[model samples]
Target chain A: MVRGMAFDTSRRQVVKGFACLGIGATLPLCCGGTWIQAVAAESFTLTEIVDGVHVFTGANELMNEANHGAICNLGIVIGDDAVAVIDSGGSIVEAGAFLAAIRGITDKPIRYLVNTHMHPDHIFGNAVFRDAGATLIGHRNLPRALAARGEFYLRSYRNQIGATLMKGVEIIAPTMLITDRQELDLGGRKIELRAWKPAHTDNDLTVFDPATQTLFAGDLVFLEHLPTLDGSLLGWLGQMDELAAIKAAHVVPGHGTAPASWPQALQPQRHYFEALARDLRKAIEDGTPLAEAVGTAASSARSDWQLFDEYNERNATAAYAELEWE
Target chain B: MKAVRQDRRPMAGTASKMAAALALAACICAMPSLAYSQAANAPSEKIWNELKTDVFEDRTIQSDTGLIRIEAPKRAQDAALVPVDIFIDPAKFPGGIKSLTLIVDVNPSPVAATFQFGENSGVTHLSTRLRVDDYSYLRAIAETANGELHMAQTYVKASGGCSAPAVKNQDEANRTMGQMKLRQFAEQDSQTGKGRELQLMIRHPNNSGLQKDPLTQYFIPPHFIHKLSVSQDDRPILSMEGGISISEDPNFRFDYTPDGNGEIRVEAVDTDGKVFRDQWPLEAAGL
Candidate 1:
């Protein structure tokens, strides 16, 4: 009861402070000053990957209040008449900050908002883009994924990032779903969106700008970060070659360093995935139980990735659950 | 929390301790969220105290008898796939164990399952995965042939923040529902002498249906395996009456003394009255 009361008190302060920040809005005498510092802290820089493609490389960390839930990469592809943004971000505050950054660069109408997948980190900010009148685009499976997990995401992330940062976050499903492939032309710049077959997730969608040959490989291409498996492990391993064959000069991965050279950037993750699969297969063949096998399942790749300790065992557990059926 | 952990009687034998250590280390590696760390400090026994009366009906359950031992991660790695192990000492139960009831105190469906063992069935070890919705006590209550109830319990910190106890691939689960797979291994139990181990996996969504469709605002209809039984040579080994607390693709692994080289058989029925049955020739011991 005490804990609940404490949480509610803090949440009320946040709401009160938020209302005071809007222009011409009444500043209540009870409003706390924490919201002022929080709002002022909302800013992130976007790196121009090419002439028309800009990538806002998020910090290589998990979603947290400190990071303001901006842990996954967000992209901005500009054109003469319109713009297409890749991934909304992890929280409403981060998305609001991202919108402000885009407005600084161009006044062009934000035409298309693309979601890479249904992970909370990538789609929590969907409301910001939807409110901006951008037509949301995602893989055909996105709606179902969101329907199944959207409420869970909201409840869970509120606990992770706190109510202050999650102020206006909402799970806005995409209206324009791509079943196979779709092309969006922002004036003369041509952007190709291809939905993959359940690689990193069931609804993974990649945004490729042919003009600059830059590929926005959502969570499908994790570099420094260990790849978390929520979909089929076999499906992801089987599609590695096809993903590498995408003709792109550079790639903006969902996490870690941005604009990495094509194909080569995937080698490290490929080795990690293969190594994990081999270990899990051996464990299964030896009749090792999931609880015992997962401890050392992917220990061989422990030195190769960031957050390996945090995500490896979970990946092993999920992978073991999948492979044991085979 | 400390008092409750300290209250647990020390598990006898090196094998049980080793198994407990391994399970703990694996669970520690799987704790991804820092949110649960704070929860460990605020232990709640209120739910368990209130739940016991409705479950056991005023029957006294002995906790210090050392007849049963239950093992689960202090913090679940995945809410949907929390592995749990229960070991019953054959030496303590001269009449053999009769039934085992598993309860996850905080889950929407608190009573996860109840398993009834066949007469003379040398079943001493059982392991299965469960879905823990929140920080709760996972207890295993065992009833011996003499009608004595002995219990062991462990607190599991759920991965509540991001991971819901929901199916990962709903489409894949639906497509493969009712499929069954079995694996066999040889075991030499110090107490039961020689025995055979069997791992049975059944494909089922085991949906709790507690979740509302955020779009439609309607509860997803609950569907899950409600009944399952396993036997060897026409002799019952174990059977369960389960609930949605079981993970998707329900799985069970256990050690039982093989009477003969008869075929091992399994039959499972879901809430929809769909029956799935399969059998495999019992592999020789020490394979």
Candidate 2:
């Protein structure tokens, strides 16, 4: 039998540490003069993509298996009066850490918490900000997405990890809903929120920071890695072109490192989707079996992109089926 | 003996004649019933027999001394593709190992992948993105210092991972492949410089065979990363073997002895032969 006893000490330490962190109590030893240093050490490091707008990359610390995409970049838009958080992150603890990071940088209250989509990793932390009085904002489909999967996420979190971290995490519904587009002013700073239909999800909202010429293009653009498909591939490809037309100086992807040019950042995703859609269409026309179509289409894309080898066939297959149905 | 002798006598002859008649009557009586049962129970019996054979089979796994360590979820929230990690203990196999194999008994194809490590490659660790066909035993057999296979097995609850969607977005997900991110969790306590954890995230679609392409009305093909390597300062620390059980955007954590300095590098090779590499510089905190 495999020895389970060897991991006990480490497991105990994790449980104890989690218990302390879960209650939000400062560790006693670190609470003295050393505590100040710890807090200073814990300060959220912000890398400025442009003046006034910052990307709060979560501490490269915390080995989270979830939220792998934006593990580093949590795009923060600081307005003159208040700050708007683009994605809330994976959990209440993470959101709390994010809020603390925000507090360290500026005293401005979080005026709005805009959700890019309904993915749990992006929206699970909504309750933390909502409890802190930030107005939750999202697309019209947000509520439905949350309602469908929120309980599942909660159960998974509690069952897989532990309940302490997710305790009291209420799924807060977005108070402000946008169907197509909406504009908001944060103390004279104009922020445009647009609902991109059936792209990444049923409804994906992108926040444009006009002053900084930065667009928080949620999952619309994943820099470097493979994109996960939830919505229509064709729709996403078209949206990418539209996003390229926006002419933003910087694009903060829902995941990956921030890109200096919005168009360049979105190109990889565009090429992938276009190629997938094109190949799938041809396969459907040729009457290629679904399995063969996936293999053939993915193999073709494999030579150009490294990540494609992992997901291309699957993407093609899914795109083919979705398109076939449509 | 007396009973046998008596039964064998003429008294038994009359009994035998009656027995023959009875036997004929019994065959006549049972033939239709036997045919009816065969027709009724064959399909159910086949399923039962398969289950019975699988349950009774002796599945024994042997491990090479230090070549591989299998890490499975203590409890998996989603049964479909439970995240699994395989690490090669460098100290145990100093000559630097080659080739890692994963055999998941419940899966349709038990042999997930066989990886050939590169030269001078601290390619001791691999993490793939995989699929688990069912709740069954999983084995990792590593060829070690002496060219013998060392094995380890862990029981994983199987969910229908093959059909899970690659992600919510087909296009955006396609763009993110080969992009790698490394995150270091909070430092250990100052008193104990032990117990450091690093999380590595790789972007991939991790397509399992079960998802229906909404457009084509067909099953998406299964493609996933079969191997991963995590190294520190050019030294091997963890190697992973992955299958369909690995979720999309596969993320994993590795615990290691801290030198308190050196860059941690992660390189992943997917089933389709795409390679991605990323590195993170270690920060020296007193802890």
Candidate 3:
């Protein structure tokens, strides 16, 4: 059921109607041309890392009105005939801007819109791609994850990022599911998609461009941004070796700078995970309550990462719940 | 009472809790409901005011009585799993508390869980995780053997907890459902003879029933551990009537005086009528 190719004419027309309504005054001069892309590229720049691959590194900040919820890395791969997108960004505004940026690069029909996980920061712009006739692709478990958390994300993020930006946002589940591994061909170029065990998230999927030796390690290999765990701690720590084993010359992490050197970029997160686990294990062994232990569980790694104060205790809380079962 | 097995239906207390949940659900569906209006203020006095009558039914509740204390994060990192600690001082009521009720006032089902303590169980402190749906009061109401209620509460600033969805690994969660484990801790030297601590972990989804299936356009029915009883040497220690507010993979850690010999037993029942039982030989009291 790859609904992405269905091309819902009515919805696209409605979306077009809304877009025109936003900038109706200037439509006569630049209505159907590259006006949108020209405007989009003015604010959002997609840096070309390799030959045809471009990366847009978002701000290292939480999703707020100021950032427009563009807090995750987004990628675009241009091929001979079609193009492939890594993520949709965090809002309709972000996604629209991203699609315009892609249009700025190439008019190739976006053959696939790949979601790395179920986090809103990565997939909120899906509706825009769905309108662009790009087939949505994700992990097999992604639909279930989206179904479960989609409403909550919509409701909660409205408060975090404000309602004006949340308008027209829809939680669109992927139709093409990658159970284990799948190679998507954008005309002549082939990109690999691999779904991993529950690590940073249960439905984590990574994209690798073989031609460029670049891996889009979605939230799996965070650098500067503190990794938030919505999945199993033990599962994540257990699979670090396997994740690091992926032979990628450069990596585009979900929340960090683009083109990070592979395997080496994993060190900081690995250290943070080990520190948090060590502290939590000691606390559990010592009979210290979760409420008391999480206050200082990963304090050793606090100064190393950004947003440590905002997410460390929360990560410690999640880790404590998972580790206590071990 | 060794190896006692009771197939209990929803008891009166459980039924009222369900009623409270249904009433709260109705209140939420009604336009401009209390749940929505209370979100602006952290310590929503209106929600607690309405929830008190629904849960306790006009009973006099004494707050800040020094008998019980509830601790929770001021702003939860993860709304789906907020750690809550409830400590009870036995000296305040030497007769012992008959039961304790946990309530998250702004949650869809405010009566999170109610536990009935066994006679001489020596249980004084209870710690568990809850899904706080909004910025609301997390309350622990302890009923003395004489039926007097003493309350302690803290305001937790969190939202979207009850409807935060089930575990991320849904397949693994289902596969491991109903599995139980109990970890025993050596007696603390400071609280000698007060009893050792035990952490009981059970694998259950404990879904809040608020998540809607996008394909079906209806809520996935709530599935959770509704009845749980833990005992030592077949003597009752504590039992609980729980609801969806309990986190996935329900866990409870508490201090209990273990009998010198025999095994510790646990039996839990979910909404689907699945029964799971496990027991472990009690270790030496101090070793």
Candidate 4:
């Protein structure tokens, strides 16, 4: 019922904006893209990328809108008999909302919850699935990842978000740990879980759905958004090559809109990484200080990406430090 | 010091006769008080009363000259893990204190860690990482000279250290474990040339039990370094037992009197039983 109200309000706002824009149609279009060209105006909220595969492009405000930097797009993939949720949001509340969305689609129980990496924003919602009797799955390094920072997260969540909302949130380790690749069939739907090594994170898992010809690429691919490289710049760039090789019809990134093709979405991140690696290597060879390298590296890549002004410098600094010894 | 004495006088009256003995029993039987009375007032009060009975009741902690000294952040920017430094006065307990214990009264596990230092250890100065559940007073108790416990305390603001993810990738972080670096800050001038401050950086995940896997939609298991040993010229100087409060890739600074030319060795053991060791060469400098 509340959803209907929200949709009605949003429709009215869209109509009002269109009415005002019609009066300014005579003015030379100041914006680069047409109203039709703007992806935000397309009204693509949550949609099924394929059969039983739903992707919620979290509200832009909920995503890369503020201090909470963009890392990955959260996703949910439901199989025939049971649902396999991918990349739980940053908090239990967010995860609960995602679970509710899943319930709205089907009555299938969430049997498997897979984490692509150990970043806090992606995994802080594990407790919600564990409470619902879903078996958590991730790479072998995930247990160590959570164990290292679990208590601290619980305390922080209680302090920042309030303990009541986070009640019964348990930091449960993944029951199933994948080493290289693991394949599971949820009824007739085949899901392939592949652990890509030393990319994005120490252990990054990419879920490929054969039935839908769709690949749920975690942080490995960022479409129309800045990519955060917590792993080696060189390693992530190499992984991008492997991801591009995957012939999937649709690619769901950890963040941003669903990619129509792998090359379009994955190539930019690879290019950014390549650019970062090249600059960092040159700086190291020249014995340039880290601070100086940051400016030179970011300025070089500024024109290539959209959110370069926001994260390029930091990315350059991280890339420099990461590749310095290598 | 005098105020601590005055505060005990009223307790003495409550323990004078039959009522005193009963009160003493209640105090000993009850639990130590929970530190945060501001947030969870009712429950924390209950927990505090329970703790007051279970621990810290009728217990007299002597503040000797230098038995135990606790150093912690006056205001922490992050609450998950806070660095805590403990120094035992050499004069007060000459036989090299046996064990040191930390009690963060409000944390989920109040007894953070207990370390048993060897006899060869000189002027015990141990630093460890810990998780502070809230803004609370942290107590460091040392077993000393007369086989009695001496304690010192300092208040630390709330920090979310545990929830904070390790900055680097898991593999990159793994490759750098056991790598130790010592940075010496500018020393202050003193006539005797006694104290020198040095910052030590040790790379370890120090995972607290609160973070989740980004893609899996599940919680990551908790694993953290539990013990640290520092030695100079192959001789033990300090050893620390850690808890969830230790920050990831712990950076700690301590003041010490260096002995001429010696190499410092540091060994750390994580809760997952992973051990790492590194060495740093000591350089002589004026304080």
Evaluate all candidate structures by whole-model CA lDDT and list the values in order. Answer: 0.77, 0.57, 0.77, 0.59
Model 4 over residues A47-147: C-alpha lDDT tens digits? 55555666756432222212121234566666667778887766554455556556656788888899988765677667767766788899887776566
Task: Identify the runs in model 3 with alpha carbons over 4 angstroms from their true place.
Answer: A1-42, B1-43, B159-165, B190-194, B214-216
| TM-scores of all candidate predictions against the true structure | 0.85, 0.48, 0.87, 0.53
Error of 4 at B269 (Å): 7.3
lDDT of 4 by residue, B30-52 (tens): 22322233354234334534554
Candidate 4 vs. true structure, TM-score? 0.53
> Chain B TM-score, candidate 2?
0.53
The positional error of residue A26 in candidate 3, measured at the CA in angstroms, is: 8.7
The deviation in Å at residue B112 for candidate 4 is: 6.3
Please state the error at residue B132 of candidate 4 in Å.
4.0
lDDT (10s digit) by residue, model 2, range A1-326:
11231112232211011222333354222111232111111333455556556565542222233432124356676777888888777655556566665665678888899988876567766766776678999988776555533443554444433454454455666889999889887776778999986776766899887776778888787766566565667788766668889857777776666644657887777777777777777875554434456666645445555455445544564476455433
Q: Every model's DockQ, to 2 decimals? A: 0.24, 0.04, 0.43, 0.15
**Order of models, best TM-score first:** 3, 1, 4, 2
Error of 4 at B260 (Å): 3.4
Show the lowest summed lDDT stretch of 10 residues, model 3 chain A: A12-21
Model 4 / residue B31 / CA error / Å: 8.9
Compose the digit string of candidate 1's lDDT tens values, residues A112-213. Answer: 999999888898878778878799999998888777676667766766778777776777889999998889989877799999887777889999887777
